[model samples]
Target: MTEAVASDGNHGSGPLEYGERRLLHLQAARKLLTEGEPIRAVARHLVAAGGTLEPWAVAALREAAAEAVALSAEPEAREFLHTARQGTDSPAVAAELTDLDWWIRPAAAVGALTELARTDGLPSPATAVLVRRLAWHGRIEEASELLAARPDPGIDGAVTDAWLSRLYPGAFGARTGAPALDEVAATHPWLRADADPGAVLQGLALHRGALEPLQMSLLALDGAGTLDTEAGWFADLLAAARRSSSRVAEALLIAARARVELRRGELRTAEESAETALCLLTPASWGVLIGMPLATVLESLTEQGRHAEVPDRLRATLPQAISRTPYGLIYLRARGQHFLATGRSRAALGEFLAAGEIQRSWGADHPGLSPWMLDAARAHLALGEPAAARELAGRQLRGPGGDRPRIRAGALRILAGTVGPGRRPESLREAITLAERSGDRLELARCLAELGRAFTEAGQPEYAYAPLQRAWRIATDSGAGLLLAELAAGGLGGPPVDPAEARGLAQLSDAERRVAELAAQGYKNREIARRLFLTASTVEQHLTRIYRKLGVRRRSALAAIPGLVPAADVPRPGRPRPLCARPGMV
Candidate 1:
């Protein structure tokens, strides 16, 4: 018979030694098992032994497996379940094992689980997996119904419900109340102590629109000033994810880091991190959550001027349910930017407007989340509809996100384009100041470029030189090839011109000269018409006459001539003087 250890200190103890106390605890656990106590009563003691299963009873092993599953200790759970299975073919043990396996390798278990749900119905342990699967497949209503059928949905079910609530706030009839991160950690001591804390942290960060708590949590976890730097925090989180037993949790944490990197303008790192996260799970497994990483990758690629690679990246099969989430808005905006870069202004405008409609419907029309109005305004400007552009920019300026420096700067930049040359510098200077405050280098470059163009259009060559040079350096450093191209097309960054190109300046009328300068600077007839407030046909006629006078046939030949210099610098009598040639001359 196994020795029954004393619970009371009846063994005349002065003070028990460490070995004696451990032996006593082990014996007491065995005594409880022999006395027909429930396996759960002694399961913790047995698990604490932590070795080969030969010394443990089958019942104790099964209970240990269940406890490990609850704690999300996948490897320990698998080992205990395997040992228990060899001794007995208990269906409850098998179900627990299946659920454990389903968390990491859903593809292998989804078919069996689906059929089980259809027929005899899932055991409580398996229900959460099926619900998640249904939601992943875009059967959200069905998932909600199945979850509602279960009265006590357990810890896993509650976590899934919380994620769904955040991902699609109003998709179901009402919001499901989820426990806060602290509450969850307090209630489930096992999760707090043994399982990865990142799972809880990711759930809290999802769709919540705040990062202070996340940053604070990381600091607390790593001690003061240890993970305070962005790189350090990101690495710490990534290390935690790697050590986690759940692949889903790891992917979610990595994706979250990718988004943060994207916002910080670390494009290469964001793209790599997002790609790594996507590779951890299959597309169907990601469901609507795939949008987080996929959007980051798409936006990074698009911004880098690698437009040719975008179509293939976009060919992934996404769940239809993604369209209802904030992730979808990100993807839509990124695609619109791509369209604009590729000269599909009308298509880009349609995408931007569609995103705006969705935002309005969802009542999430905050410009900080997605400045679709500014995007639409940019599309309008590209389409040569400055009035429409101005209207949209003005509306954004007067709306919710207008107070944000970055959003305000974007609106001002667009507004400057639609206004007269006399007012353009003021709007653009304010835009430049706001862009600098926002710390977005790309935005600053855009504003500076516009200011330089305003100075150029006003025939203030001396004033244009400084802003254009500053913009050139910023654009080159930011890898903004599109902005660089725009600056180049505006005749801001080019070699010094030969004086001989000025010979035809005296032969053209003022209107014809304006058209000729714009043409030489690479503006199409429609674009020139928009800038000069003329019809396209009139601009085309002026271009034809200018080309004849300059002895040029194609627009390329026009570009070959040196860009417009100040009329005062031209050795011709018919040219007009610069508007802002010197200080106090405006």
Candidate 2:
């Protein structure tokens, strides 16, 4: 008889602590995850544990899969994720327990999805829609095949149509070229969670096809003002989803952002909301995974010029990211951005290349591609490859008809400065237009400040003041550090300091510069480890040494390293003076 024991958040007890069954095997596999154990640890361990695995053993396998993903061990993820997904609902069969999630309580909606998908005894519509939801999660392949496998098209249609309307809202309505819609009966419906019946009724207009589309739209809304009104609609749709034959509704329920309302005015609320969301959705993450949010938060920090904060955040979260997350692009992009911000164009280019590889794997027009292209262009420009940057930018912008404001503004600013004479006016005007349309007040402000610099460089300083002043106003109100830095550096803030008259450089080697540049760009020791192909500990050591040599105490100071930049008529060998702040105050 095996002892039943607990594994984090998994309530009740299980037969044997996974470790106790074959403690030696489990310990050895864990070491292999770090030390390159047997190269066949999973296989070797499975053999040792009697060809059958326990739940904790399964949990351990999942954990190892997670580590492999963190290490960019793509080969391992394909094998591991497939195995874990297979074990999701099996109560009697257990193999490896590295994932831990298997032994623990499965997240409500996700667990429902797993059970319903594998267990056919449930209602037809329930399992059918459940499969479709799984498809959308990008976990399984297309749901169409699963739907085809069912004998009842009517039930499948109802389930699929219901989910579709909820997912895309306004998109569900019929247009001249649209497919003919079969009506879903109002009485057999499951959607009843609406706080206000009128709005949803209006949105759906009693059209069954509109339900999933609407639900999808509501789920994607970002602003508080809109999300506030849409919350009840989401709840209703989610409620309907949960009650439907497919347990997939629980997936959406776990994904619902209605809780985001609780922290309308509080930043802490987002943190709490994210944590709760993570816990709520636990093991099964319908395609709406954690990587996106982690990337989103990191990008927000980049906008704030706090790029150095990325490592600590990643240290806390990366281990938890799903193996197949498309967020791989984002991780590399942020790493590149950190390097670019710190003036290491060449090293940044490597990261951009790595990110581009991942993004391209998804497709060129993938939404994530826009930002990655923009970052890649910046990297090229920093490396003094203006022609290459321009070519890439033109291709990307043309495909989209235009880049998003942030990318457009950045690309144009670079093009305006780098590709001069005849193209200057056209690029500057485009940059200005982007600055205006971004809606991020600070983003617009940075554009304006950069525009002013463009004018001054183009022998139009007299035309620069108005835009600079406008930029200044936006920055003061937004309190964005990067924009503030731009205003100060452009000499529109206060008096400018001479770079040569500034402090001296800390003696650094080529590798340290590479390390510092990436560090400044927000690469954690682990990310840096992967980039440099060195051990995580080695990256830390390099960072420590770089800090000592640079005379600055933290990774944040790498950007301001005076020695890194050639003297701009400033003195050397001292600490950087605090930058002049207020545009006028400076």
Model 1 agreement with the true structure over 1-586: per-residue lDDT tens digits: 1233343344644376645655665666687788977665565444433322344655687776666655556677777666565555555556556655655565565665555455334565467656655665566767877778764655655555544544564574322454554565565432343534344354442211112234223322321111222555456655654554656656766676666555545556667787777778777656676776787777776665667768877787887888786667767887888899889999999999998998787665646546899999999999999999999999999987787788899999999999877789999999999888766667787888888778778887667766876777665555555666676678645432433444576778999989888887778889999999999999988978888877778878876664552212211111121232322110
lDDT of 2 by residue, 1-586 (tens): 1112113214433465545655645455555545654444653454344333446545655555556534434345436544554545543222122122221222334454554455444445444455545544543433444554554545445545455333322222222222223334343233433333334433542122333544444343331113442457556655554443233333333333422322121222233333333444432433434454444444444444565665565664342223233334544565666677767888888877665565455443333222556667778877888888887677667655255664567667666656654457577677778756653454456557766776767786666666766776555544344556656666644422223212223355677767777786667888888988889888888888877765678877665543344223211122222232322110
Deviation from native of the Cα of residue 534 in model 1, angstroms: 52
Per-residue lDDT, model 2, residue 326, is 39
Give the TM-score of each candidate.
0.63, 0.47
Candidates in order have lDDT scores of 0.65, 0.49
Clashes of 1: 0
- RMSD to truth, every model: 16.5, 20.8
> TM-score of predicted model 1?
0.63
